[model samples]
Target: MQTRRRFKQTKTLSDRLADEAARCRAEARTLTPGRRREMLLRQARQDETAMQIEAWLRSPGLRAPT
Candidate 1:
């Protein structure tokens, strides 16, 4: 069987997500208003929202749902 290549991630998920959102925003700023720019901005929003949800999940006061 062929094994998949595995690599270790150096940055935490939150950090990685933040970096991605920032990169997307920067790229979007450089593009003219259009579908591609809109898509990039949407991705950036998603990354930011994910980061928020992750933080909320990790909060100390949260409990598992029934």
Candidate 2:
């Protein structure tokens, strides 16, 4: 019997962008609102795409200031 191989799913664009932001934070690099908004808007301007951005923001480390 032959078995099929299973591969992990590729990371979504939102996941990748969030990782970029986190890496920038870790490196003490500034993520200005203009840049962030641009990144988010680029992703959020679609049907379910907005949800990914929302999910990213709601992630434990990505919250906005209260």
Candidate 3:
């Protein structure tokens, strides 16, 4: 039987996502206005959205489904 690989993550999910978004935005800034830059910007937006969702999901205000 093969055991699943385990790893420790030093950063929180939101932090990682935020970092990735920032990186994407920075890289996008270097590129001329085009598909690749647009794609990078889109990816950064996705990361930001995911981070927001993750934060919402983890909020203490979240209640269990009835």
Candidate 4:
């Protein structure tokens, strides 16, 4: 019997937030106008979170290694 190992790459927080935002937007497209509003809001929040993560990454505090 041979064992196979699967290699998985870890996703960064920004990447995950971006992916979630995309998924929320895609789902919103399939929803009714009334329901879509909530999804759109969720997508916006995800996008905002991603932007915050990116901003944090660029901050001077994070630039230097501890």
RMSD of each: 1.2, 11.6, 0.9, 5.4
Clashes of 3: 0
Model 1 misplacement above 4 A = none
lDDT of each: 0.98, 0.59, 0.98, 0.77
Best by lDDT: 3
lDDT of 2 by residue, 1-66 (tens): 999999886997567666655554544334456766565544434524555767877789875779
lDDT of 3 by residue, 1-66 (tens): 999999999999999999999999999999999999999999999999999999999999999999
Instruction: Give candidate 1's error at residue 41 in angstroms.
Output: 0.3
- Please write out the lDDT profile of model 1 over residues 1-66, one tens digit for every residue: 999999999999999999999999999999999999999999999999999999999999999999
Q: Can you give the TM-score per candidate against the true fold?
A: 0.89, 0.31, 0.92, 0.54
Deviation (Å) of 56 in candidate 3: 0.5
Q: Which of 2 and 4 is the better model by lDDT?
A: 4
* Preferred candidate (lDDT higher): 1 or 2: 1
lDDT of prediction 1: 0.98
Of candidates 4 and 3, the better by TM-score:
3
Ranking by TM-score: 3, 1, 4, 2
